[model samples]
Target: MGTKFTFYEFFAGAGMARAGLSDGWECLFANDSDELKQLSYADNWAGEDVDPRDVALVKASDLDGMADMGWASFPCQDLSQAGPKLGMGKAGSDALTRSGALWPFLDIIRDLATEGRHPILLALENVVGLLSSNGGADFHAICSTLSDIGYRFGAIVADASYFVPQSRPRVFIVALRREVPVPGALRGEFPVNPWHSKILLRARASLPDTDAANWVWWDPGAPPAKRLKELHDLLDLSDDADWNSDEQTERFVGMMTNSHLARLAEAQTAGRPMIGSLYFRMRPDSNGKNVQRAEIAFGETLGCLRTPKGGASRPRIITVDGDRVRTRLVTMREAASLMGLEENFNLPPTYHEAFKLIGDGVVPAVVRFLAERLLEPLASHGRAYAEAAAIQKASA
Candidate 1:
């Protein structure tokens, strides 16, 4: 064998990183706390041995002898807008304090470094809110800490829309050891910034001229990448999964109608022209719970997928036709399709688990994008390290 690169995945929920990295790297260890997710992961990677233990409860000392690369898609409950904004504090003290799981990640890195078993590469994923949390103080702290630990960090905000139909945007950080010289010349050109020109102009008007650096100017002339997939294109309607109960469907429709009416009344009260009716549907689970709901927007694309939290739930949808008819909720297969999982990717035995996994899992296409553009370039360095070790042993 030439060389084998090893991977240790932390917070490896349902093996999103595993799905993306397994083909490119050998996974030596994986961990997660959810039993359902663990079962799903085991089912997905049938032959791979993964231990479904709680990482927060596991000692870093136990990981002293395994893996060469570490990949963590830690729980973003503390960093996500969906959760509390506890930027690196203990969970449960407050809603904001609940979102700070970044510390656990750092703790693992610190332990690995202390034992001189620092992985060659470290990759982390989280919500974009992490960048501006605590007025960017949290981001600074994270970068500074990693630098102190002898790692050079680079980050990018990649949108799933680039490869999948959904508009899920996430922040990814890749940290490499300081001893490794980054191939700066091979760094891809920065993606063109895309924002509504009117929004940018309005934002600049609010800022002082001295603070021009804070304003982002959109390049209207730049040719953007093609908008590749659509919400409908990813659905596998043939699958008999993800149906809601009649009661749940009625409740969802009622909620959507009420929300739509509220918006319509608000527009009328503001003297704005009333748009057509917002069509929506209820996506049911096997147990008849309304796991997901979809609403059609006036003309814009489908709103981002989010966890359904009762009030004003789910992303908004736009209606294509002029008639203002209501629509049904998105199907389970559609959700899976939108997430870019393979057509037959492990279907949870229950609707609730299915929605949870889809909501929590990383989009496969986004993972593939990282693998090709970011991770593959570092492969040669890993191979070189392995080869050097082999030569040293042979000479000895």
Candidate 2:
């Protein structure tokens, strides 16, 4: 136990945070509402029983003596672009009321702080849409609430392509207790100053001023030379893998073609649709290597993997061999690979469930990057605070 730190994970879906943090800290307790997720979590990590209860069921009082860090990757339904834009209000019939989940986290933080036994660090994860939720009101409320609880915080948007083959982009927030003095006077500014070059380049073109606001701008001067991973890097690519059949492949092609045609007909030449672009550039290729061996190109990053609806759907693979284009639907293992999981990352027995799990979960490599680079620095600052406090007490 070199420098023991305990963790309490709320909304611990599939335990990605636990996987990342376990290397540096001890996960004392975990909580989530989904039973299937709990089962999956148990299968991967031993020790620490997951309290398989709705977030509301867990009392903040119960966590009084538990841990040193509080981690929450709360449900992002209300804050994600994919969900209906219901910011902390009544959820539509089809929408998940993610706004309701905030209270549990707030309660736990408030309760622990009142007892003077609060965790020194708090971390949160969510979609980028959180920044603009309710015209930024929700973001203001969240930050203000954390500030009121005596925590100084900041956030950064990191893309999975920086570390892994996936293009999954997520926002990670790191907060430190006010009592713990930050290393420099200018705390609450983004910790990682040197961001990925691509982001800096985008910022340079998109933002008004380089230093007008405290926002970290990506510097075009430091362009990354190495190309990001594509569909192939994400795929397991095992010889034994099964691929889709000819009938299924044809059905997908037909459906995509139909969808593309509709968009093309509706759009003007100046306002061409993404579907139209995909269709016009479409090529023919083998369905898959076998029943499961679906291969995509390594030239371009794969599109975001969404929950499969009706019909046989997955990412489309485009092969370029001397201008002769070949296309096929991606496979389950390939889909898993796109989410930044290892080839051997476990999945549920059911294919639908496995797809759902991958879509819902955070990219492990992205989480690990945050843990090591971002969270670890903040936690290290906490250690410095503890050391100074001990010294002051001794002098007194």
Candidate 3:
């Protein structure tokens, strides 16, 4: 490869994000704490630089070499919508250190800066809940820290539904180290663009105006996504495998609310084939009763895949064919497809492992699209600087 841009994947879970950077760039280093994930990464990726250690314990010397970009999809459990809403607000305490795993990544970045080899671009991915956690204070604190370290930050709220069949809305932060004047005041009207949602707007408003100097609104012109009539469009031949038992199917239906049951009945009685994906959540129903309700999506879109921690955490497929409602847990391969992974990607050994690996990942297609746009300007600038320096040396 000729001068390929390289990146370090911090929190590189099973090399999924690295899979996204396969086309134009290469991974210089990868790190994650979980050994199971590390085994998956090693099995799938041939990179020898894979480091399986807690990020907090990783030293700056370990990442001494320079790279063009750094990708961090840090743990969002503490800040996720489904998990504890402990935002990254703690300063120096253990709770802060634990809940805000972003701190260790920040410390490493600071070390890189000290080494005078900081990556030109730093991209972070996390759940959208990061913006609202601690009333938007967590995100602002991150912005402030990035600004302090001489990097200008830009962010966008992107949804995997735009690229894949799953609705995974994540906040992506792209920070660049460049000199620029203070960003102008926020416009009176913040447009509800695809890249900026209401939550993003509120998060931006929380930051001090001074921090805006390095803040940019990143918008890559996204083409309209193709509409899906059914979830089968994204399914593979291997996804046809069913693992649900009779008792399991009954339990799943029993969890559905009356309204959902009626809808299923109506769809079945319509005398046509109706295919949908189901997700269970223990929440309130229309009758103000707390119960496990089966939420079905009729279109190509499916709900976000989460780690299979509980019965509700796993996604199930509901197919209504000629008055028969057949249900089965979505196959692991189907979960991989939903994550936009390549067909030939090596999956983990067990079903739960495979599902977990894909579920807690940045969709590969989305990452490739975003990373390409984010690197364009930086690449051009680097090339221009190198050419100028060459011309000066030649003249001398």
Candidate 4:
């Protein structure tokens, strides 16, 4: 691990990916537009500074030196299912959507190429909705553009639940420069489970043959599954735990449907400590009116964390034991833990502010898994390594 793999992080939300990249990795540059999020990034990373400026105004000359990898988890709002479905802004037009931040990021990468400083590895992370947004036109553009920029790329749909407690499924576009020799062990001839889902396959199939030819079927392999924690274990269930009043909890529980109510009843009589995570969503009633519903999951895996935009929906931790009932907003520290951050990572005091950072960012553990399995090897190994792996793959 003596050799450090240097990276430039764009849309570097509190350096979540940096924390995931772990040891033997060095961040040479980072940037984000939100000053508030930048403050959070500064708090966690001692001595490492962030360029807190709009990506549009950031010129390629602003970047320094060569990097082994350049990662941009550009704004996902425009492409997220929960967000307004605005496509990546027009290529050259000044009109930009929220996710248009990717345009400038690509511009910088293109500029770096003119200076003959192309980062051998490049990755783009975003919501899985990107694959189908605008009737799959957006996905086609993504593949074509990467091919146009001289990259052999592929998409992987990895769920955060594989490594963490939350169920956030994100799309990672992993690419290598067209001239680079790829380790055969890093990819496969066919799409497989855990990374390539049917939706992703359909997207690839829809690609023009020229674009499809540039696609590599990534096989990063399955995660060593962690012991799935019960909600009783992940959260503090003691009587002294931070909790809302019984009245508030009872009122919230009253909003549950009969099916959810039955689960609550089971928790009340489970003869032991039983906790549930609650995510509120608007659902239709018998008459078709969209009524607010308090959906509860008794299992350990919590629902995905959503960005705090417009009105923030704060998730609640609920537990009902015998005659006792309680519910409380999920704390900032808990949110950090669920994102697989170490206890030392800095977080904002308020729940919404902290969620804004954690919700929009990639899970660090997920990133670490990919780095260990593929990215690091690609950055560190050479042509001989690729050839040897190819031989081994063929024999197997």
Q: Give each model's clash number.
A: 17, 9, 1, 0
| RMSD (Cα, Å) of model 1 | 8.8
- The residue-by-residue lDDT of candidate 3 on 285-365, one tens digit each, is 678888776666665577788888866677777777665667777778778888887778889878888877877888887
Given candidate 3, what's the lDDT at residue 95?
59
lDDT tens digits, residue span 226-319, model 1: 5556544554323253434546544544555455546544444544322222334565656878754434343213445665554345333322
Best-first order by lDDT? 4, 3, 2, 1
What do the candidate models score in CA lDDT, each in turn?
Answer: 0.60, 0.60, 0.76, 0.82
Determine the C-alpha RMSD for candidate 2 after optimal superposition of all C-alphas. 8.6
Q: Identify the leading candidate in terms of lDDT.
A: 4
Tens-place lDDT per residue, model 2, 39-109, is 87887776346888877668777674746679888887777665677775422223436754765677678
Candidate 2 lDDT score at position 384: 75
Model 3 shows how many backbone clashes?
A: 1
Question: Candidate 3 lDDT (Cα, whole model)?
Answer: 0.76
lDDT of 4 by residue, 1-396 (tens): 577988899999899988888867888889998987789888988856799888888887887887888999988888987888987866666888878788788888888877967677898999998898888987888788778777899989999888777788999999888777778899899998979988998899899999999999989987766734434455666668788787877788888999998988888888976666787779999999999988788765777888766442776777767878788877777777778788888888876788889888899888988999988888876433445767989999
For model 4 the local lDDT of residue 47 reads: 56
